[model samples]
Target: MFVRIVKMGFQPDKIDAFFENFEANKNQIRNFEGCLFLELYRDKNNTNQFFTYSYWEDEAALENYRKSDLFLKVWGETKVWFNQKPEAWSVDKVVSLE
Candidate 1:
């Protein structure tokens, strides 16, 4: 499987807005074709920082989603709330412990 991890830092005041948007759209993103799983995480000490971990069938699957209208809408609204540019990594699972 393909994995994607994205780190996002938002304006302190925009944290709640970002979370609300994620909650509203998580289902659609998870249900998108080739998506296997989706999850969100927040930093304990840095409340304004968040991370998204998702599993895709393959890199191409992820690329398709990135180019989709869903991404355009979500990212378009989301980028404005960022305090700094976001970061991301795409990788393959090396091993499984469970």
Candidate 2:
């Protein structure tokens, strides 16, 4: 499995709108091919900071999703609210307690 993490910092006033847009597109993103799991997280001390954690079957699968229309539509709108460039990482599991 491939794990993808994206950390984003949004303009303070745009946080709520960003979450609303994310919520609206969540299902569509989660349903994409090879998307095993998807989740959103908020920084404990920073309301305008968020992270997206997702699992895919592999890099190619993730790439396919990234290139899909669903991603284009969501990302196109989401980028407008960012206060800074988002950070992303793709990793493979080394160990899992569960």
Candidate 3:
């Protein structure tokens, strides 16, 4: 499984808009091919910081979603709300915990 974690920093003033966009697009993103799981997280101390955690069948599947129109539309709207550049990680599980 391929895991993806994206940390995003939003402008405090733009937070509401950011969530509105997320609410509007999250399902479509989750429904994309090879997407196995999707979850959203917010910082405990810093409300403006958020993270997207998801699982894909593989890197290619993640890449395919990145290339899709949903990503373009979502990202285009999302970046404008950022206080800083987002950071992303693609990882593989090395240990099992279940």
Candidate 4:
């Protein structure tokens, strides 16, 4: 499995718009092929900061999503709302309890 994490910092005023965009596409993204999980998280001390956590079957699945037209539209609009450059990581589990 492959996991992807993205840490995003949004312009304070544009946070709502960012949520709207995520709400609009979250389901579609989760339902995409090879996607096994999806989640969103907010920073404890920073309301405008958020992170997306998702699991894919493999790197190719994640890459396919990145190249999809939906991604193009969503990311294009989403990046404009950022107050700082977003950070992303793709990784595989090293160990698991269960």
Candidate 5:
């Protein structure tokens, strides 16, 4: 499986709007092919910092989702709210305790 993580820093005032946009389109994103799981995480100490953690069947599957309209729509709107460029990483599972 491929594990993908994306960390985003949002402008304080734009946080609510960003979440609204995400809630509106999250289902469509989760329904994409080869998507095994999807979730959102926020830093307790820093509310404006959020992270998206997803599991995909493979890198190609993740890439396919990235190329889809669902991604474009969500990202296009989300980008405007960012205080800084987001960071993303993809990695293979080494081991899982659970």
Candidate 6:
């Protein structure tokens, strides 16, 4: 499995809107094909900062989702609330205890 982590910084005034949007769409995202797992996290020091951590079957699977209409809609709505450009990383797991 591979992991995709996205770091997002939202505008302070738009945080609530972003939260609601994520809550509303998270289920569909989690259920998308190739998605093995999904999680959302907030930065300890900055409430406006968040991260989406997800696991996919492989690169192709990730690409499929990235190209899907669902992504287009979700990302379209989400990007407008961003205080800065989002950053993402795709990587392979090297080791895990559990």
Per-structure clash totals for the candidates: 0, 0, 0, 0, 0, 0
TM-score of candidate 1 versus the correct structure, residues matched by position: 0.97
Candidate 4 off by > 4 Å: none
Q: List lDDT for all candidates, in order.
A: 0.95, 0.92, 0.93, 0.94, 0.93, 0.95
Q: RMSD in Å for candidate 1, one decimal? A: 0.7
Minimum summed lDDT over a 10-residue window in model 5 is located at 22-31
RMSD of each: 0.7, 0.8, 0.9, 1.0, 0.8, 0.6
Encode model 4's per-residue lDDT on 1-77: one tens digit a residue: 98899999999999999999999999999999989999999999998899999999998898999999989999999
Q: Model 6, 1-98: lDDT tens per residue?
A: 99999999999999999989999999999999999999999999999999999999999999999999999999999999999989999999999896
Which of 1 and 2 is ahead in lDDT?
1
True lDDT of residue 19, candidate 6: 89
Better candidate by lDDT, 3 or 6? 6
Steric clash pairs (candidate 1):
none
Across 1-98, the per-residue lDDT of candidate 5 in tens digits comes to: 88999999999999999889989988888889999999999999998999999999999999999999889888999999999989999988898996
TM-scores, each model vs. reference: 0.97, 0.96, 0.95, 0.95, 0.96, 0.97
Off by over 4 Å in 2: none
Model 3: weakest 10-residue lDDT segment is: 89-98
lDDT of 2 at 10: 97
Task: Give candidate 6 regions above 4 Å deviation.
Answer: none
Per-residue lDDT, model 5, residue 6, is 98
Q: How close is candidate 4 to the true structure, as a TM-score?
A: 0.95
What lDDT does candidate 2 reach at residue 85?
Answer: 97
